[model samples]
Target: MIDHPPFALFIRGSKVDAFAVSDQLGFETGMEALAVSLFEDGPETMHVQALFETQAQAEACLDGLKFPSDMESFITQLPDEDWISKSQAGLPPVKAGRFWLYGTHDADNIPSNVPFPIEINAGLAFGTGHHGTTKGCLLIFDKLLESGFKPKRVLDLGCGAGVLAIAAAKALQQDILATDIDQDAVDVTLQNALANNVSEFVKSYQADGFDSPELKGQRFDLIFANILAKPLMGLAPDIAHALAPDGKVILSGILNEQAEMVSDAFTKKGLEVSPQPSLSGWTSLLGQKP
Candidate 1:
């Protein structure tokens, strides 16, 4: 038997275009982990990194690529350390209103005062409740729950890691459609849901923003979308169409400067937008279909 060590691949470019490219690659590549971020101390530089199961896999994937002229690439052996566990261990538990989110590494550390505790481990996908956008969405979900809103039909669009969907399922004890454009994200969501013991309430699928036949005729009383600004604006009509009468929609992943544009798109679709508190420059909006 032979052991194959994993490899780490990275590319660097400007954040604006590089981030988008990195995101597309992340969705399509099925890497163990992929991330795009601005390089600290160098605001203009962006980094896109991916981890592959083997060096051969990484090289083969990169060989078939059409990287931009300015994009520089690097491949190296991934360290033997348990990076995932170590990374998850560093994230402190976060409280969003009544909900307390902690990774499995700190499961035993959950406070006694926290009423709703969600266990989310760091995985190949997003939404560990660390990102501002995710936190904002969680806060919106908490507020909705506190308001006595019981949505029997729920949809979590672009539900990376399925945190929002899991939260809704646990809170409402109802079926939830968790869809993501990436199949890997769908798998990760299912895994996370099972880990949180909410798998019975959550179902996942790979769909490009309501394109799946599974979602075509179905309407949801509550829809949660914690995706980017452009996609959120573009999907406004689809979201509105899929929403049941008097239904609620929670929108996050909009930068502070882009919130107005996103809000206007949904508002024009007959949704009355209610602003939620911003966290770390991200805005979360709650809307009601009238």
Candidate 2:
């Protein structure tokens, strides 16, 4: 496969707005693949990249586009190689607490004595354990497990790729309810769950945040919401109300600077935020309902 250089643009805005811009651009022809990612750290911003098969096509798209004042566009020409394979190879296996996350490419490397082994692949959704927020959540959950926290009912809100839900299933052997606003993400989660051999314990749904009928009058012993700071803040009340007494919540996908704001939102909703925070450009906070 021939590798063409990827062109990208930076936009200063929330992830929701960046996705809106991507959807608008998708309507126009010639744009093959558009990857838009929010900054891992604080200060909500987006890095949007457009992938093309040819240099001429990339230049044409870059030159013809009318960029907004807030958008900074650039083109990068990488060495000729199988970029997809190279990228996957670079991911390696990520270990957090007791959980070991590896892609199919790294399958043979996993030891038979591994604790909480999880298989994940880069697909339609996020959370392959490579992102800081995901790793942070895993570590927090491990700490909870170490402290003898036995959660019978669990919810993985915004269950991107269903990695958290899968981890819960593998570790606790309990059924999990997972949901995401995007159907593609839900699909990917299901696929990932099956790949991880936890499909029987993982139930996924596509619904707006905390608006699903399945969530009615339901409370969870533990809830994991690894979405962005804004959405996490908006879901604070729902999260607090859905938690079982003395239940814990793992919140990630936040910038270190935005951690206090998110923690305050949960705190105002009657949840006590844990001061121990993890960062990878992004931050993850652990909170519990008193």
Candidate 3:
């Protein structure tokens, strides 16, 4: 009478993860869990399982399993190796034909154009055009361009892989500064900038969260940040501090349910929040400082 989603890690079950399991449990031997079989044996008595975030959590759940000693002989772990994938595994377009956004691996397929093709080689970082939240930001920013907001300067925060930064540079005629807490992401963004020929337009920096001394007293005509909800709330002061009066901002990477919370954070700092459509369940926000 329980629906337990086992906390599972994605390792080929019988291999390292099994070894890790035995080591973690202080057991002399380890056996991988065999897949459930629904055969003509008897009743389809199901084994209980649940997902735990860590090994400790998994062990705790294991402690609750009530496997009768008589039934233990029927269970066994199968080999974890798997190779049942289709040809479409690497076929690009995590979600197809939506204006070619380059988030995760986006730099590899940079968008092309006459004005300029802002190539961005994104890696394991978040906030490429592929993620729903990032794509939502791009859509709104496109509208900003359509509305004739000619920005001379732009700033992108939490610039994972600098995808948004590159897009703003190419879309708005260059002149961008992108920052991220992770140095690897910064490196990837610069590489993408160089690839897309927007190197001149984009600059990069590294900081913890958003309170770097390097960015103090700086303001921009356009600002973009696609970070998650909680940190974005904490960043209200810094965001407001960096945006120019009368400038506009495009914020994303928040769920629709939490949009109001993020909006309130900015509203208290004098940034006017307006609703942009949700991409998937995440919210995109637009605001202006007058």
Candidate 4:
């Protein structure tokens, strides 16, 4: 595939099988893919669209996918004009606390009296603020706030668009450090923070796991990590060490079964994993160092 700035791929096939294939490929290989399963205007046939960064990457991944003998698929690159126009369209609004998150297109329309409004245009970033993992963490964070729980310092690991950091900064009005492995994500996070006028309260950095030299030996009253199971496990030590006594930790983006392994890693480091809350088969684990 040509090295297009913002590439997109479309795949249509047996919707269920296509989703399964897409998910397997994503989790196993960390491919850039998004599966959309839908029924057309009528239910005669199911449809699946798997978006990818490059036509050749999508094709190569699909070539190795093990589908049933009868399963079928068609792949093509979306026209540049269509892709650009569609991507430039409005994004659905996201809300947590009194904050409202809008994309660039919608930010201009937000009312001035609102408590907070942030333009979180992710561009080609992996997170778009629509995933269940993200929404679940927001819900749990809401519950914590409703109960009047407050933490002084906050950190968002694998911050993506920095939604979690933005949420924490809005809630605590404290210094928030949001870090991601991808520089694009760091830029997106900073842009979102500025749009919300929390650029002073929330800082963005490009860091993965414990590789962030600035975070070394630092401690926070709260930490939110919404990464996958493997990295979550690998960072258990850093997470535990960086947390203050009685610090609260929130984690997501892993399934129920995988939670045990992740929880165990943290537990061995003296953090106690609380019960998990389930959403669409994925699990969010809460822990505290006490």
Candidate 5:
């Protein structure tokens, strides 16, 4: 098969506007992947990058969008290269709480004191532990583990690359149900679980939200959902229903300004919600089902 270059459509604007555009592109264009990052010029500026398999698709998606007057938008074809490896090459090992997340390059340098050393390399899926949302979830979960919160049934919703599921499996030595909307992500998660030597403890499935048979009539003692804020809010009732009594939920992929809105959504579903420390302009919320 011939190799094809990926195309990226970029939008630059204020943080709020950038997030809005990101959400819009995700919902409307059906792009392969989307990311939001702080612009290099300053923290106040935000950049939204949407990746597509074809240049035509990127251009068409860009043309369909009605961006704000102040926002800037454009499309560029990336070089045909191992972009995933190139992008991940510079990422140093991230130490979140007690969990040590490292790509293969840092495998030899893992500290002796770290109990849970998870080897994850950036790939087609998300959550290599570098993103603020993923790191925040790991930090919060690590603290929970430190506090003697032993959960028997664990679920990693929107498992992405299965970093959270792998971490829980490594620390708890318990089965972790990992689910994601994309099949590629499910495959990647399972591969990562095997790479981390936790395949026996991690089960992965491709499910849209809570619709999969694997999640039917299941109640989890601990759940992690590091998805976008809008989807997180919409899934509040389902998530609340899936939690066992006194169960805990870690939520991320939310902007700092939108934290309260997401928290209120879960609160309305009878969950006692609290915000974790904001990281890199993103917010993570912890909720308990009373």
Candidate 6:
């Protein structure tokens, strides 16, 4: 497990704005590790925390960013503790549609009737199924399964903790190709799949979106891309090209306001797009290839 940094730069604002800032910090600032979380007191409010090795580095990064008037930014010294594991241990089980997502602490508390129990702890990667985007994708996938949609080939692009990939493997009993741009995410995904007893069904690799030896000349019946709106839009053509005929793609990590833009990108790629229900100011889209 990666240790938490001693200092952090925090940005607090509306969920949409905070998420945008997070993307900028991750992509532009070249920050090593960043996390976005909802404020405990205000679900609508979100914060992006970027860790740093030193107090000066944290303050310097915070000073470099141009924050909106409504957004607040500051630097703080973090406690030298395994806060990631501690926070994860306190997280309650999340039931998204038919899937029950829980950390190791809740393993014994899993209900008997839960259709899919995914054990995901907060580690070096993301996607514990607590985020709205992950939950939205899971709910949509559950609905598709209920509608008798049986996909033979599945791909989980940006497969952070491999929650969606593991879910597909568990529900369909088929092999899943899970990819992530971050090597840490790939490693965590593999570990999570093994812990869930789906390691054999989940083939994970560190690859940029849809551009890897494993994905070459491959078509998937279902693809899950729970990434940000900009990346999703940029990847529309590639995503469409990689999808098999009549294949379905679940797209999330989009704010409600950005849904139409994301939908337009997929639509231009000749994929039929339908916006799923909004969850916690986020929107998920279902795209079908012709």
Alpha-carbon shift of residue 239 in model 5 (angstroms): 1.0
Task: Report the lDDT tens digits of candidate 5 across residue range 99-191.
Answer: 999988788999999989999876557678887889999999988988999999999998978999999999999899999877777888999
- The stretch of ten residues in a row with the least summed lDDT in candidate 4 is 36-45
Tens digits of per-residue lDDT, candidate 3, 118-228, equal 433223344446456777877787778878788787888878767788777777656798988766667778888787678998899887754586577778888888876
lDDT of 2 at 125: 62
lDDT of each: 0.79, 0.76, 0.59, 0.69, 0.84, 0.84
Best-fitting candidate, scored by TM-score: 6
Least well predicted 10-residue stretch by lDDT in candidate 3: 33-42
lDDT of residue 79 for candidate 1: 68
lDDT for model 4 comes to 0.69
Residue-wise C-alpha lDDT for candidate 1, range 1-290, written one tens digit per residue: 11444577777875444545556556766544433222311445556666677787778767755567788888998667766665567678988888889988888898998877889875567777876788898888887788888888999998988999988888888889999888888998999889889898899999876767878888999999988888889999999999999999999877777889999999999999988877756689999998
Q: Write the per-residue lDDT of candidate 2 for residues 1-290, one digit (tens) a residue.
A: 44354544434444445533443343233354433233432445555445555666666766655546565556665556665666567577998888999987899999777788899865436677877789999999999999999999999998878899999999999799998877766888899889888899999998775667978789999999988788789999999999999999999877777789999999999999974565545678889998
Query: Among all windows of ten consecutive residues in candidate 2, which has the lowest summed lDDT?
Result: 33-42
When sorted by TM-score, best at the front, the candidate numbers are 6, 1, 5, 2, 4, 3
Model 5 CA lDDT for position 159: 92
Tens digits of per-residue lDDT for model 4 on 1-290?
A: 33443334333454344444534453344455543222222222234345666677777766776767665466776665545336546347777556666777775678776665656653434345555567667767777787788988788887877888888887788789998877766877788778777888988887756656858778888888987777788888889999999898899877666778888898999998975667655678888999
Number of clashes recorded per candidate: 0, 1, 14, 0, 0, 0
lDDT score, candidate 1, position 66 = 59
* Deviation from truth (RMSD, Å), model 5: 3.4
Model 6 RMSD in angstroms? 3.2
Residue by residue across 165-256, what tens digits does model 6's lDDT show?
99999999989999988777788889999999999999999887566887888999999999889989999989999999999999999988
Which residue runs does candidate 2 get wrong by more than 4 Å?
1-71, 74-80
Candidate 3 wrong stretches, greater than 4 Å: 1-91, 94-99, 102-122
Q: lDDT at 9 for candidate 1?
A: 75
Against the hidden reference, what TM-scores do the models get?
0.85, 0.80, 0.64, 0.72, 0.83, 0.85
